[model samples]
Target: MPAPNPACASNKTEPSMLADSIDALLPQTQCRKCGFNGCLPYAEAIARGEADIDRCPPGGDAGIAKLAELLGIAAKPLNPAYGIERPRLLAIIDEDACIGCTKCLPPCPTDAILGASKHMHTIIADLCTGCELCIAPCPVACIAMVPAPNLTWTETDADRARLRHLAKQQRLTKLEAEKAERLQRQKQLLSKAKSAKNQD
Candidate 1:
């Protein structure tokens, strides 16, 4: 789907500007459960009035209530299309079974999984948003999601995760740009070589 216009909101603040406030209230798991690429995109959709606050399974009913109040709309039940709300889940890697293919690393929004290729991978408990993003990519199927009863997600945690997610996005964008530049230079050199050979 085309992204909502960043300026679509009619509030005094543009949707892009209003996104910050909406994002602040989000769980910041960077999980795509809400049908957006990340929490910020979902917030932007909400700001643009394109997405409902009830779509966040991670945010649960309370989160919907908060959004409802913020938007001055009546609170509604969490939307089942996005999945039902549940307790926070933490991803655990089975060390013995972990193949260390590094496939799981890229999916983690927080970069919580740490390991080199061909080595045992481990998840940093505190950094893990329990987004369950790492589980699907594991080639060994060794990753498991378990309820995190002792850990409570808070505003501070959300803020830190948000910053990390943004940083990761920047890093990925830079890498893609560099890769494109390298490819362009390679193509130019090949073209030059082909021309030189033809002339000779």
Candidate 2:
């Protein structure tokens, strides 16, 4: 479909911005459940009026309504081409039948698999969000989706380390921006105070 023109919404705020916000709430599985490349870009199209809000199966009805509200558009029925959302599942490797091509490793979003090349790999079920982002990447078809294991399943330190690092970076950026704003405010206050003193 051709993209929505900026004039599509009469409201001051453009639809693209609201669509981006809605996209952020979606799972980044790239499953095409929404019939888009990924959640982020689809959100832009939806925001811009190029796509329907009901296309995302993962978001279901709730997502569609939320997007409509955000964009000031009417809520509509979901498009069935995307398929229904299912419960979380993890890809499991049948160890005996496995020929370790290691193709699955690169595609795993959470780094749930553990093994070297030409060696058997195992899925870390706990870390898996059942996004199914890993399935098509496996050339062997050895990977099968099973119910995700319970809470006891754990990811290695590497995963935790990376997550923490990214979080800390974000926090630092926020703090820095706040500090700069505070300093600017203080400078303005001091200048105003001096001006008043001079007038006195």
lDDT by residue (tens digit), candidate 1, 44-139: 888877887888888898998887777666788987988989888898899999888999989999888899999999988888898888878777
Q: Which regions of candidate 2 are displaced past 4 Å? A: 2-8, 14-16, 149-200
Report every candidate's CA lDDT: 0.86, 0.65
User: After TM-score superposition, what is the CA distance of residue 132 in candidate 2 from its true location, in Å?
Assistant: 2.4
Off by over 4 Å in 1: 1-10
Model 2 Cα lDDT, one tens digit per residue, 1-200: 74463334665665666765665555544445676755667777766667767777756676677767766778777777767755545678887766788887655555667888889888776555455666787776777887665522222422442353345456668999999999999999999999999999
RMSD of each: 2.7, 13.2
